[model samples]
Target: MMSKSTPLAALAFALSATTALAGDPVTYQLDWLPGGDKAPIYVCVDQGFCADAGLDVTIASGRGSSDAISRLAAGSSDIGMADIGALMAAKAQEGVGVTSVLSVFNKGPHAFYTVKDSGFDSVADVKGKKIATSPFTSSNVYLPLVLQDVGLTEADLELTKADAGALGPMLMTGQVDGIVAWMTDLSRYTGQGKDAGKEIIALPWSAAGLELYSAALNANDAFLAERPEVAARFVAAFKKSIEFCQTNPEEAAQSVVNMVPELEHGDVLGSLNDMLGLVFNDVTEEDGLGVFEPGRLAATWTRVAAAQGLDESAHGAEDFVTRSFQPGGEG
Candidate 1:
């Protein structure tokens, strides 16, 4: 056996293995087509945050939370961009192992829309009236908790599931009376000329005792266990990306537009600027962006549990969220 060559041969083999481990690729599924709400993530990619984190991150459009969760739990996806509600739902239905790392949109963007002249002034006014919503959201789940605070309950209203993206027009036309969804950017739907003069009455989750997190960076348990250092890097870079977006809104908006051409005309900046007012909020500005609040997560889970018509007990509660990656994060 050649003497001097032996040492060098071993070193080359070791380096190859090290590089392979370091270069492990990871893919993340976005909850919808990329756009303003997903701006920071696209900005992160454009600005090389993921690369700096030693991750080759891929963002793709998602069918919905259930699909996103299914892929993530099945290991078809290494990471997912989803809301706490999705995570809670998957845990409730299948006992899947998923965890949320960073929250992109700190404020829950769900709300109900009623015609300005409907005479439905408050939550109580919704009583005995038809209200439309998607059962998949925290808004549907926590209606009771919030209505309780507003002096209303499930018995007070007739609930219905309005097809997604069809609610805005349905509300503006007075077909269903009221529609529940994001306090949609009026500019978004009206820009399409479908719902001109349509107004959305904003009922922020914070005010309604539904302070659960929305739009978080998530991954499954196995991925986290196998590569924690990699996970930490991703979390850190994502946090840095948020700071960059806040400091440079124009650049951030453009980055997201590039990721989704349809959003170029969606009034990204104006809408994001408004959503930012609701999302950046006081807690985010003070505690780094994307940081999770356990109390809020718990509150959201409670509503989700009530919505599914079952109360969770025992160890599975950990399935909702985890703080292991947050404490040392840049946030």
Candidate 2:
């Protein structure tokens, strides 16, 4: 009485039903090589938020911001973590699925460091002086525009390619007069051969009429459409993790050190504390953590487009964001 196709169809239905019951697996690629700098993500993973959300979230390290963006564009990553600069660049080229869901740094931390005795009172004073920088970062190019506003050009100084570590010595030892770095970076370098009376002039990027957020959450399109619920849960847990970090910084730092062990650049607690101060200050307490307002962040996208020559890039907050996964409305 039972037809062959009917039995086969029933079996297929049962198998499909079973698969649906299984949790969706996803991997999140970090914007940079994992370290204390990525403490919040570790906190999220260790706290079991990913598991609670029915997502087997596997967080892995990326070569750099660009590398992370590339992987996110390819759908190789379900949720990709990266800076707004890199994400905007990716959106320009491929019309990718990456959309911002969280803002890691509410304030930009970038500033140039100079010894107080150097007689540099402001960001504009380093004309004809030696400067150090890590190339390809938003700072490398944006600094030039910033300098132009103060009547200084790249030609006014000898620019050397360098990282945060090399920049300080280049200053203390007099290799470079000043370096484009961050305030938090200066704090880290204070004990490592930092001169006692060497007061620093902090050149905040925000003062130049430009406010930029450093890190953010970007997810692949396939994931957004097929698994919106999973995305929302992860964001929810990520917000809680941030809150936990803000309230319990010392514990958060220790937790991060436990999760990642390859960090050799500096003390785990120091970096974790410093990074937390930069991204997760108590300002997130009111509306909740990792909150990104579309209107507030649209300016950042515009800045990214202008810097990367994205003349043809679709430049709308809508193209790259869906707040349905965040708090308030579940974007």
Tell me each candidate's RMSD, in Å, in order. Answer: 4.6, 5.1
Distance (Å) between predicted and true CA of 284, model 2? Answer: 4.8
TM-score of 2: 0.83
lDDT at residue 93 of model 1 (Cα atoms)? 73
Which residue pairs of candidate 1 clash? none
Worst 10 residues of 1 by lDDT: 186-195
lDDT of 2 at 12: 97
Number of residue pairs clashing in candidate 1, backbone atoms closer than 3 angstroms, sequence gap of 3 or more or interchain: 0
Report the CA-based lDDT of candidate 1 relative to the real structure.
0.70
Winning candidate number (TM-score): 2
lDDT of 2 by residue, 1-331 (tens): 9887998999999998776655567788887766566766777777666666666668777877778877887888888677777777777787666787777776666677777667766776778788888765557756766676677778888889976557777777777787887655645665544454455565676566556667778887788788887777777777777777768766766666667766543465566666776575544564455767665567767666766778634567556667677666554
Q: Please, what are the lDDT tens digits per residue for candidate 1 over residues 108-142?
A: 77666676657876655777888888766556766
* Alpha-carbon TM-score of each model against the true structure: 0.80, 0.83
Cα misplacement distance, residue 288 of candidate 1 (Å): 4.4
